[model samples]
Target: MHTLDQLKQYEKEFIEKGYFVLDLNNMEYVKEASDLLQKHLQKITNNSEITLYNYHAFFEDNDKHYEMQFQMLQFFREQQFAQNIIQSNIDVYQFLLGPDLEIQTEPYLRITRPHKPKDNIGYHRDTFYGTGPGEISSVIPFINLSEKSTLSVVPKSHIIPDRFFKLNQVVNTEVPKDSKRHKMGFLYAPKVMDPEIRNDVIPIPLKRGQALVFMLSIIHGSEENNTDYPRWSTDIRVRNSLTSLNEAMKAGYYKPLKDSATTQTFERLSQ
Candidate 1:
């Protein structure tokens, strides 16, 4: 949990740099998240020692990337993934998003196979998908990763002029050359952004259990997995309490973060 000042400091950094790091002193959540998928991995590959990053190697159909991802997500929802988010930043949800919390996506797992540059996701903003503003994406690596195997982001892209990487200007791109859409897909190569702005993209490296929180407006995307080990990370979206989620948002689209009375009332009423 963070103090009011700590939370505000993070908010300042997030606003200025387009992202902030929330470190988990106790790494138990990473192990718990991994354990939740053990049964499924065992069934798929009879390999008990397989971990998140290397789990994809078990699949003979390399193209089944999305299918594997869906399976992991389904499993993650049943675990304590949500609890960890709040525990990781109790004040963040309160001070950042507010007490009326809504978790947009069930925390999701991302796996990048090794030596697959073509599969790397191109740069893009989450706002382009119409997720609304103040949306935060939480990313935590399941294994220690080199800089080359992590997410590359353009800090402060959100504050850039609207003329930069506008929807019509740049298109979605995928890695691995002719590969389909990337698992961590966002905006790909920006053909229109000026040279100075384009040079801002830099790789962000995080070790196991460390979380990086970024506003949805930030321009970010995954880089290729250049190491022998695959890169496994978790991603979840969240919106604040005041955001008037429309009809398309649905009832379960977001959930409360803490044990606040507001969340308790929502649970009882929804039930």
Candidate 2:
């Protein structure tokens, strides 16, 4: 049971910092999500004890990477997986957006192979990818991470003007492009922000069962994963439940996350 005052404290921090990190150690879904991951990896690698930290040891094959990743992402479409994706961070969502929310159906799971420079994405905003101002982003690393092993984001960058977003759109395309080219916000930091912007950027070192919550419009990116193992993480975006049901957020694209009593009553009456 969280309180309205505590929620405002989070909002104040978020509005001033563009993002915040929280420990999800007690979150029920963190263990569930990890177990689910191990379950799938066991089938793929025939290793019953596979963990996210050892992700590289199992399925980083050049040949099978696509197939393996395809199947793993498809698993995200499962109700259990999607539920964990959103419900695990429900409190964070209520703080960032509102009590009622709708989360991305096509939530993503990313495995960054070690020594891959290209894996370091660019600094950009989610609005370039069809997210709205009402949206917020979520990140959970299944393994421990630090600088060059996890995400980096420019703090308070959401308060910047929309010109950078427009420029990113010209380079990244509002319409979906190859996912590889997408993290341009992290890629072209100079084009998006001033030379001093680097001062604002900070690498978030995250442990397993920790989550980073930020505004959808925040300037964020990642660095090379030089660690011995792959960095396994998941990313999902959510919006106010009352946001317009655009194609990107409609029935097939998003799932109902939480509904306020007022919303539930209204829906019941409308039905």
Candidate 3:
């Protein structure tokens, strides 16, 4: 367990950069959790393409799926690993927003599997998807990853509040010749408001079970999973309690819940 002071240091890093990696100090828990999750995922998926994109849990038949398309957090909750995440969330919110801050976990799970050449997600901010007015997000690696498999991000994109990336600009881009997206779907390449700011881009590589937390407005994306092995990771967002979807529903930003997976509550995410 980390002292509040240590968590504050991590929060300072996040304040300076858009993201910070937790030392996670719980390798045994991660190994056990990862093994269990991988086995669980295998029982439901053997599809080459969907597996390549880390899109497995989208199917209703894949055990008890929750959130976006992945079901690992459900396992975390069932296995008591959720306690660790909750503690981190509490410490993090306190460190970043003071003790008065509250946090809420939304119902979206992003599991990314960079397989083959073209499955990388394109450069975009979470605001594009309308996730509410909170900055905290967690990315947990299910496997140990090398630099080639790390997520590459533009460090302060979230701080660039005046500029927003539009869906249209990204849609018209030609996939890079060196990118895996040419063969797969579309690659997630990092874009900057100014190409001259090369120092803004950083590649974050993580150990199995270690998670990186960042702001949602952060301009981030990933590179091709070029290794012979598959790279799998999961992302979940935490909204400030005051900006929660439950509050948004009362504010009339979102309709009552429906079965639509892609449906979003827009008011919390953007104006």
Candidate 4:
């Protein structure tokens, strides 16, 4: 586990750019997490009655993909394995976010695959469930490589004021696109490339079992996953405990989604 001082150094770097990557190297605990995920996937595939998330169904059939997600959620909720990874993150996150910060597990695991020319969510900020500052997030890459479907982020984009990141003040509706902050990268206009912003856009690659923490207000997007292989990862949001309840209440966010057994499944073709 990282001590307070070491974590602080990362915080400084993150504030300057909105995120930082932590390398677990070959730590036994990290290795255990990876193995645990593999085992969980195997078990979930054996079960039926799961539904896949919209994006996951693209590669595998509906039933089969749904089962894959069930296994993924199992991995997220597995106390033994999830704890090892979560505990390591909490140590550092506490310092970066605050002593009161806690981890909120998402309902599904992500299996991003190579994109066709048309595939992309376009430029956006992750303000789906929160408003204002103090909103932060952490993503753990269960996959084994950095270039494996990595996400692109605009450095320091979180520094933008609340008015820009916030939902509507008039109708109280969420801002569909963060038009004010400016998107700078593939498939969109980049703030870094703009002579006005002067920030450089860089591609961040993460190794297997690495955790990348960043502010939610950061401007970011993913390039098309060019490889033939699919990329698997899980996003765990970490926020000040006080902020969790408020953010979860905003609209579409789930703290620890209420269900357990129900999940998206992928059906295999006949043998």
Candidate 5:
């Protein structure tokens, strides 16, 4: 847990830079989660040698690879992996957000294989996906991330006016036909179409034990992985429970992760 002074400094830095890298206080839970993923991958691939970085080598078919990824996402959510990490790092979250906090129920798993442009996300802000400024996003890498495979963000871009960039809504129509898509509606996210804006985006490298926490409005995305090893990471969104939430998010997309004493009291009294 960080001291009050330290947390205040962190908040100031976050406000100024729009993001910060944090070293997780408890790596035990992180390692446990990583181990669980590795075991599941080995079981599904039937190859003991398969690792997060080299799992792409086992699948030649794009559909099969995506199917594997979808299955892993299901497994990850079913196991409540994000909840464990949040619990372990509750202090930091509370300091960043508030004591009353809600977390996105379905955390996103990003698996970018080397030289796979299709797997990379385009530069965009979460606000384009209906998220509000109250929400913050955290990215946790399962493996060490190099500059070539890390997330890129335009610093201080969160405060930029929306009109400054030409944006386009991009729907992902590449899901494997055989696999059951998790969300029914068109899965889409807005992408920044301006060529000049791309120049400001810079890669943010992170180690296995570090997490990148940033404002949702920041213009950010990953580049095509050019390294030999694949990049694997999971990102979850969190917000103060009292803050405004989009209709979809309020309708059960987000769940309570922590509650203040006042909130708990109100819940009990209402019940």
Candidate 6:
């Protein structure tokens, strides 16, 4: 846990650089989550030797891979893994997002297999998808990440004026027709189409037991995993409960993670 003074410095850095790295120190929860995932993968693949890094090798069909991804997502939600992670690092979240916070109901489980370009996400801001500016994005890697398999971000890009760049909604046509992503429509992310912007983007290498917290407005994405090992990570959004939220963001997409004493008292009195 960071001291109050250290957290203040991190807050300044996050405001200036659009992101900050936090040391979780609590790897027990991460290990438990990863173990749960591996067990699920083993059952799905019907191979006791299945591991997260090598699970991709078992799927010869893209449709099967998509189906597995959806199943994993459902399992995560059913197990409340996201909430468990948040609670494990409650102190850090309280420092970053305030005492009263709300977390994404279903955190994104990003699996970038080695040499898989189709799994790569494009550069964009969460604000483009109706997330409020007050929301913060957090990425926790289950395994060590190298530059080739880590997330890339343009430092300070969150503060850049919108007029400086144009956004185009890019869709992944490669998504299988029967996949849930396909049914969600072609609208994926509003990407910055200018190739010149790539010059400023840099991959952030992360070790296990660490997290990357960034402003939602930051222009960030990941490239194809070129490393020999697969990348497993979870990205979730959190914000102060007092902050303004859009209707879409509030539509069962977020759940309260922390409540202030005043809020607790009010709820009790109301009841």
TM-score of each: 0.77, 0.79, 0.61, 0.64, 0.92, 0.91
lDDT of candidate 3 over 166-213, digit per residue (tens): 334343254564442332223334333343333556778888757777
- lDDT for each candidate structure: 0.66, 0.68, 0.54, 0.53, 0.80, 0.78
lDDT of 5 at 215: 94
lDDT of 2 by residue, 186-253 (tens): 22223343435556678988877777888877888764777887777788778896766446644566
Which structure is stronger by TM-score: 3 or 6? Answer: 6
lDDT of 1 at 165: 58
> What lDDT is obtained when candidate 1 is compared to the true structure?
0.66
The window of 10 residues in a row where model 4 has the poorest summed lDDT is 179-188
Off by more than 4 A, model 5? 170-172, 175-189, 248-250
Q: Candidate 5, overall lDDT?
A: 0.80
Estimate the Cα RMSD of every predicted model relative to the unseen true structure.
4.6, 4.4, 10.2, 12.5, 2.5, 2.4
lDDT of 3: 0.54
- In Å, residue 104's CA in model 6 sits off its true spot by 0.9
- lDDT-sorted candidate list, best first: 5, 6, 2, 1, 3, 4
Q: Considering TM-score, which of the candidate structures 2 and 5 is the better prediction for this target?
A: 5
Show the colliding residue pairs in model 6.
none
Going through the candidates in the order shown, the clash numbers are: 10, 8, 7, 23, 0, 0
Regions of model 4 farther than 4 Å from truth: 3-5, 44-59, 78-83, 105-107, 116-122, 161-201, 243-271
Most accurate candidate by lDDT: 5
The predicted structure with the larger TM-score, 3 or 5, is 5
Candidate 5 per-residue C-alpha lDDT over 1-271 given as tens digits, one digit per residue, 9 for 90 to 100: 6677877877887899899887787777777878899899999878899988778888657678777888888888898876788777888889988899988888877788888877776678877768875789989988889999999999999898788888765545563332344331114433546767678999999998888989988888875888888888888888898988777654777898989999999999999
Better of 3 and 4 by lDDT: 3
For residue 151, what is the lDDT in candidate 5?
92
